[model samples]
Target chain A: MDEHAHPSVMTFVAVWITLLFFTGLTVFAATLELGPFNAIVALGIATIKALLVVLFFMELHYSTALTKVIAIAAIFFFMLLAGLTLSDYLTRGWSTYPSTH
Target chain B: MPDSETVSNNLKHHFANLEQQTATSKFGMWLFLATEVMFFGGMFVSYLVYRLSYYNAWVAGSQTMEITLGATNTAVLICSSLTMVMAVHFAKLGKRKLTAIFLIATLVLGMTFLGIKGVEYYKHWVHHEVPGPNFHFEHEGNFDPRHVSIFFTLYFAMTGMHALHMVIGVGLLSWLLILNALERFSAEYNSPVEIVGLYWHFVDVIWIYLFPLLYLISHRHTG
Candidate 1:
């Protein structure tokens, strides 16, 4: 792998513009009434912004497969943390446990 | 010269080649960032649980935040990330002066973010928004002050942790600036710059999520 072939400045500038656009979009989107959909939309836009930064600015797009897998693994575990915990918290009231008293 | 022996002097004796060294450094950085994800993830979970349990109170607490400052800080961080990526790009091109200039630009933007954050914190303090005895949540509806204080607790915990990382990032950038001044990096051995860029971008990414989760969650209610 020739490590010297970095992303051109144009590519970085383009990514920067896209990131700023998404930032504005997320903030603006929050100002609209969307009920439960508001959070979903905000987080969705944020995820896209995060992916752009990860792929372009971090050079993961040009990295090796192992590095890519390592990155995915990190996200996988983070999801596990959030998902598993939220599942419990969201469902804790479904059935009542017998009181110790 | 043998290919192995021809590798740059910056290649460590233990590594087979420059590529290996660079990959190892990147792998280590990603792994460290993974740990940081968990570190912040805990707080996020805490916030989610409390938010679900006390929805209106969370909204009330979020409304107290200054949207202008939060939005401005987000833009500042996004621009700083651009400078950081530019620094890494120049380092790869062996342009020492450009890299140093971008690094300095990133440092300035990072400090600007902290300055704005300090002002926000000061405003909260003046308004008695801190989560303890002096804390108060002003709302015209049925909301428990204690639960609203919980929102502030999460706010301080999450943003305070994020700010701490920014402070550490500024310190690391300062060290990189000194090293760059001494000509310690070149095209073949700018892994430190690239690695630091990963750390800096990861910090920015954390805020990318934090901005929406903390400030924009219930913005329309107050708007």
Candidate 2:
């Protein structure tokens, strides 16, 4: 839509800088004592980094709306699979143990 | 109104132009990546169940892996991903030579990743960290030998699958380089470059997540 359809040099530099930032952030987070929150914070930063690579670096931002929908559906389905599978395991009852009953 | 007086570029195709072609190719690659996410999703589920069920055993297994190598491989793959994107940029701008250089660099780095991974696997084989009977490696204060098998299972499963992807990606890039050499990819028709770049970056993204989970989680902090 702008003068250039392809990403300019500046966009490329900015994305690389963002990646470096996330890399440093991930390492720093690992150094701290976040306990249960460590994995949470790490995955959060990762998702943001992946989004940047997808939208700008991979040129999803310049894509047609229909293609964007297809891309989004794929990721959404992956998340769906991850969530449902984890929940099934976490919610299972241990009724097989006679000591509890 | 007719082509008798019109140039060859006059008529519009189903898509608007070259930009639209690039867009569709990019989208198709992303959709394909979505399926890959599902592919790895099944493995992650296996990891989650076994990991939770054998919590200490998983940690024991995780301890056998060399974090430094894992971290180093992560950085290497990240560099390759950057090269891959640069290759796409060059292709879009009609620079075949630069694109080929970047693509070749990407392939080399990808192979470098596989080489290092092979070394790690060899170490597993030597140290008996690989899964199956009599395969066990445990640190004095960090793990139980019995539980190390689960760790090795996850270690091989995740990284092994990742290595498989890298092998396939390198082959694809080699083929792309040949196609580029033959003048198949150009500024006007660079969908293949775009598609391959998507695959390469998706692999990098998966490794980005893998590095943290596999390498950096318990750096002398876990009990």
Candidate 3:
């Protein structure tokens, strides 16, 4: 096989194991009703899954340190987008004063 | 004459090497994912506004959905993402046969997801719960029908968009497979596979948020 014709990167079995764990974690999270913490736990597990995907599948682990930082920044920026939007919504009606009867 | 083995033949002229080409492709994919997040952001805003206004109605509306199915889809999607990673890994390892195989598996699972989604949609249809001009579900004794309607509206908009991406992703991997079959993709130029993997995972990521927001919101009880 031509060197350029095929890459040599082989994924590890551990990657599959960890991914399965997170999938289980997500299903488990759904089983529990944590009130507000429900989203928090789900998102937290998602973040972990996202991290594993970025660090391993993308090969950020072996890349230059700066590249890793850039990858993390890209992810956090997405979170920021979600965070800002949610905050704007969750905060609305918080400051509204009801008229006294 | 430069043989295909020469770097010139494998990498685009603008890129200095295969790595550069892959990097650029990955960067472009991430940029696209950013815009996608914003696209879904608008729907989230709508959900917030309406759910806040009719809190109890929204709760009642959520009850119509089957949590088990939502949960199953979420798991299916995550598993597909892992397979996508494996496909990229095979591409990197220069295993042409394995690469094609894994990519095909990922594509099949994606299609299965769409198939399951269609079934769920059908279930919604038979129940007359799908929102639109023909929607006919009663919100029982105390809930506003409109709020439940809004839930289905957002549901269709968001998940429908997600299913569309799954379609596109399957198409993308199909193209990649064709290239692999032609021996155009190898370790040197597997960026296309890597980039496609990025896109496929990003789709999964979007669903991750959607599952919780759409299905689990305000449901502290498993009732």
The candidate scoring highest on lDDT is 1
In model 2, what lDDT does residue A61 have? 86
Please report, as a residue range, the 10-residue window in candidate 3 chain B with the lowest summed lDDT. B1-10
The lDDT values for all models are 0.87, 0.76, 0.72
User: Against the true structure, what is model 1's DockQ?
Assistant: 0.46
Model 3 alpha-carbon drift over 4 Å, by segment: A1-12, A60-101, B1-7, B218-223
Docking class of 1: acceptable
lDDT per residue (tens digit) for residues B1-223 in model 1:
2323324547888998788888899989988988898899889888887877787787778888888899899999999999999999888777889999999999999999999999999999999999888987666676788888888888999999999999999999999999888777876678889999999999999999989888987885544
**Pick by lDDT: 1 or 3, better one:** 1
lDDT of 3 by residue, B1-223 (tens): 2224534556778887776676677667766766676677677667766766666666666667777788778778777877888888777767888998888889888988898889889999998878888888674656668768878888898899999999999899899989888777665567788888878887887787777667665544555
Comparing 2 and 3 on DockQ, the stronger one: 2
Alpha carbon lDDT of residue A2, candidate 3? 24
Please, what is the TM-score per model? 0.93, 0.85, 0.82
Runs off by more than 4 Å, candidate 1:
A1-5, A95-101, B1-9, B220-223
Ranking by lDDT: 1, 2, 3
Candidate numbers, best DockQ first, in rank order = 1, 2, 3
Clashing pairs in 1: none
